[model samples]
Target: ILSAVDTFGFHLNALDLRQNSESFEAVLDELFAAAGVTAPDAGYASLDESAKRELLVAELTSARPLVFPWSQDFSADTERELGIFRAAAQAVELLGPGVVPHCIVSMTGTVSDILEPMVLLKEVGIISFNPAQQRLVGSVDIAPLFETIEDLKAGAEILQELWEVDLYRGYLRGREDVQEVVLGYSDSNKDGGYLSANWALYDAQLAIVKACDTHGIGLRFSHGRGGAVGRGGGPTYDAILAQPEGAVRGSVRITEQGEVISARYGTASTARRHLEAFVAGTLEASLLDTESLKEPERAYGIMRDIASLAGEKYAQLVRDDSGFIDYFTQSTPLHEIGDLNMGSRPTARKQTESIGDLRAIPWVLSWSQSRVNLPGWFGVGTGIMRWAGEDETRWQDLRKLYQAWPFFRSVLDNMAQVMGKASMNLAQIYSTLVDDPTVSQRVFNTILDEYELTKEVFFRITGHDSLMAGNERLERSVQRRYPYLLPLNAIQIELLRRYRAGEDTFLVSKTIQVTMNGLATGLRTSG
Candidate 1:
C-alpha cells in the first residue's frame, strides 16, 4: 500500500539534537575560516547580527556544503560537531524522520539562531538546496529553545520573523509548515522568581499560539521541565490542565530528569498509571475549556503586577545581595553536587561566580539540600502583600481566582507543596556552614522572614490553614517523609562539616553521598 516516497516508520526514535547557539556559532566560525569565506583574522562569530544573518541565509541557499567530511582542516570541536549532525543524517536516512525529529538550539533569540542549525544540517547532507526550485529538501525541523525570561517574551516575535524569511518558508513546506518550540523553565525561573517565571511561560504559550494561528502553521511545544517546582516540576495532570488554552493542541512533550524518571516510571504499574494520567490530562485539556476564569484579562493584569513585584524582590536576593553566592556555595553541597554528574550537562556552563552561568539543576539542588527550597516560593509573599496591602476585597478576589482559575490554582498549589517540604529549622542548621557568621545570620534571617511572609500570604489566598490542604494523599506523604528527612538532613550536615574540614576519608565522602540520596528520596521531586 505504500510507495518508496510515502513510506515512513511510525517512530524508530525521536531524539532531539540540542546544543547552545554559541556552539553553533563557534563551529560556523571555524567552517567559514576553513572555506576561505571569511578573512582569517575576522571569523564568522566576529560579524554583527545583521551580517551574520545575511551570511547564514546565503550559505543555506548555496549549492555547496560548508564542511567536507574528509577534510582535516576543521578544529577538533568543529569536526565533532559536524560528526554529530552527520551521524544524525545517517540515522534519519536509514530509519526515517523519526530518527532525528528536531534540532533544538538553546538560547535562540533571533531568526539567525534558528537558521544556524539548518545550515549545519545542509553541510551534513540532512538538507540540500535545490537551485532549480529554489527550495530546501530536509527532513529535520529546527526548533528554537527560548530559555530565559527575556527570550520567552521575545519568542513569538522571533518565530514570526523566522516564518517571514523566504528560504525558511520553503523549508517549512516540506514539514507541512509545523514548527516545534522548546520552552526552558529552569532558566526562566532562575531569571525571574517562581511566580514571574510561571506566568511568563503561560503568557508566552498564549502569544505563540496566536502567532501560529495567524500564520496557519502547526505547532508543538517541548517543555524543558525539571524535578523541582522551581524548575517547572509539579503534578503532571494538573500542569497539563493548567496550560493556557490552545497551548497543548493535542501534542505535548515534557522532560523528567534525575530521580524523577525512576520515581514516575520505575515500576510497570506506576508507569501505566502515569501514562494514563498523562493521556487523560492531555485529552481533557485539548478538548475541554480548562481555563475557566470569570475575568481572564483582569486576573492576567493582577498576576502580571505580582510577577513584576516578585521579580524585583527576587533580584534583591540573588542579584543584589553581595553575600548571596557565599551563602549559597558555603551553606550547601553545591561542590559535591558537581561530583555526582547527575546529567549529561555540567552543573554550570563553565566556572563562573555569576548565578546566571550556574545551571538550574544544581542551583535548585543546593537549596533543596539545605532545606531552604527558596526557588519554589521566595519573593511571592512580598509581591502579594504589596499588591493587596490592607485590602480585604483584594484578598477575597485572589481567593476567588484561586478557586476558579485552574492556572492560578495549579501555580499556588504547586508552590505550596514545595514550600511545605521546606524546613526553616534545617535551613538554619545548614547556615552554620557559612564561613562568615555575619553573612550567615543576615541571609538566614532574611530567608526566615520571607518564608513566614510567603506562607502567610499563600494561606490567606487559598483559604487553607496549611499547605496541600486539598491533597490529603500528598499531605500524608509529606508527613511521612518529614521524620526521615530530619535525621538524614542532620546526618548530612555533620558529614558535610567533616568532609569540608579536611576529613578526606572515603568513608565520610560515601556517607555524605548516602545522605544526599536519602534526602532526595524522602523529598520526592527535589532537585
Candidate 2:
C-alpha cells in the first residue's frame, strides 16, 4: 500500500485554473451591467487602479453575490468564464478542496488584477466575505502570475501595495497568511533574452522575499516554467537549488506541461527521479545548504549591467528589426504549427501578428522546431562581451562569478545545454526557406555571429573545454538523439517547402505532421 501510494498520486497534482486578467475584467463588466450597478464612464473595466481596488474590496465587504447566474443573460465569453468558475465551485463542493485549489490570474500587473479573480470567485461562492464579522473565507488560493519583464520588475512593489489593503490582508489571514506568487518564465524570456529574464526573475524573488518577510506573511512561489530552457525548463534540481535563498520557503510549485511532462515523468523510474529532485531541491533551498558568494552585492551589480546590455541586443533583433517577424514566420514552421490540432488552445492569443500576442509555447516551439533555439541564447553573447569589454579583470571576474554564484552558473549552463543541442548548420539550411535574400542573410548572419560569440564566452567563463563538458548525461542524450533528429529535420524542411509551394495534399501534410511529432518527442522541450 505504501509503495502503491508512492507510485501513484491520487489527485496529487491539484487542478490550477488560469485565465487572463482581462477575462475577469470583462466578466465583471457584464455582471455589473446585469446587476444595474451604476458607475462612471465604463463601469468596471474603465476604473483607475486605486478605484478598482477600493470598489472590489467594498463589494467583498458587502457579502452579496454580484451575478444572478440564472436570471441575467451574459455574453458568450462571460458565460463561458462563469461556467468554468461555477463548475469549479461545484466540483470543490462535491469532491472537496483538492479538486481545484488555485485560480491563477495571468498577466497580473496591478493590485486590482490580483483582486479581480477573487471578486469573481466570490460571486460563485468559492470564497466568502462576512462584512459584519470583518472576516473572509476562501476555498481556493488566488495566485497572480507575473509574466512580462516589466511586470516581474514591479512584482515586489505590487505585492507591497497589495498587502496594505486591509481586506486583502484579511483574506490572506483566512488563507493562513500565505500568498502564492507565480513567476512567468516564458513571457519574460521572450520579452527579454535568457540572461535578462533569468536575472529579472532572480532579482524579483530577492525583493519579494524581503517584502513578504516584512509583512510577516508566508510566501509560496509557483514557477510558470515550460519544458524548454527559454521557458524556464532545465535541470529541476539545479534550477531550484539556484533560486534566491528564502524564495523557496520549503514550498515551490513548478509547472510541467507539453513535452516536458513526458520527457521528465513518462516512465516510473524517470518519474521517481524527478520527484526526488523536487524534494531534494526544496530541502536544500529551504535549509540554506547551497553555496553563497561572499560579494553578493558586487555580483548583483555586474549581472544587472550584463542583462541590460544583453536585453538591448535581444530587442535589436526580436523587437526592433521590422524584417524579423517576416524572417521568423518565413523560416520556421510557425504557421504550420497553427494548422496542427495540437490541442484546444490556439497558437496565438489573437489573430493579429504581434509577438506579444503570440503565445510563448508556439514562439519557443517554433524556434525549437527550426533548431535555431534562438530564444535560449540570443543576445547573451553581446551582453557578456559588451559588459566585459577589453578588460581582462572583468573577464576574470565573470569566470569567478560563474564559479561562485549558483544563479549565474545555472544561467550559463542551461544556455550551454540548449546551445549544445542547437545546430547552426541545420538552422542555416532552414534559412534557405526565407524568400528575401537580404532578410535571410542579414538575420542568419547575425544569429551565427552571436552563436559563435556566445559559445566562446560561455566556454571561457565556465573554463570548460566544450559545450556540455561536465554534463555527461545531457551529452549522451544529445549524441543518441542527434542522428535521428537530423534526418527528420531535413525531411521536415523539404516537406515544408513542398507544402508551402501549394502542394496542398493529404499525404504531404500528413508526412509533415509525422516529422513534427517525431521531432517534438525527441527534443522533449519542443513545445
The most accurate candidate by lDDT is 1
Q: What is the C-alpha lDDT of each candidate?
A: 0.88, 0.87
List ranges where model 1 is wrong by over 4 Å: 1-12, 69-72
What lDDT score is found at residue 164 in candidate 2? 90
User: Which 10 consecutive residues of model 2 have the lowest summed lDDT?
Assistant: 4-13
C-alpha RMSD by candidate, in order: 2.4, 2.1
Residues 111-187 of candidate 2: C-alpha lDDT, one tens digit per residue = 99888888878888888877676877887888999999999999999998988988888888888889999999999
Candidate 1 has which clashing residue pairs, if any? none
TM-score of 2: 0.96
Compared with the true structure, model 1 gives a TM-score of: 0.96
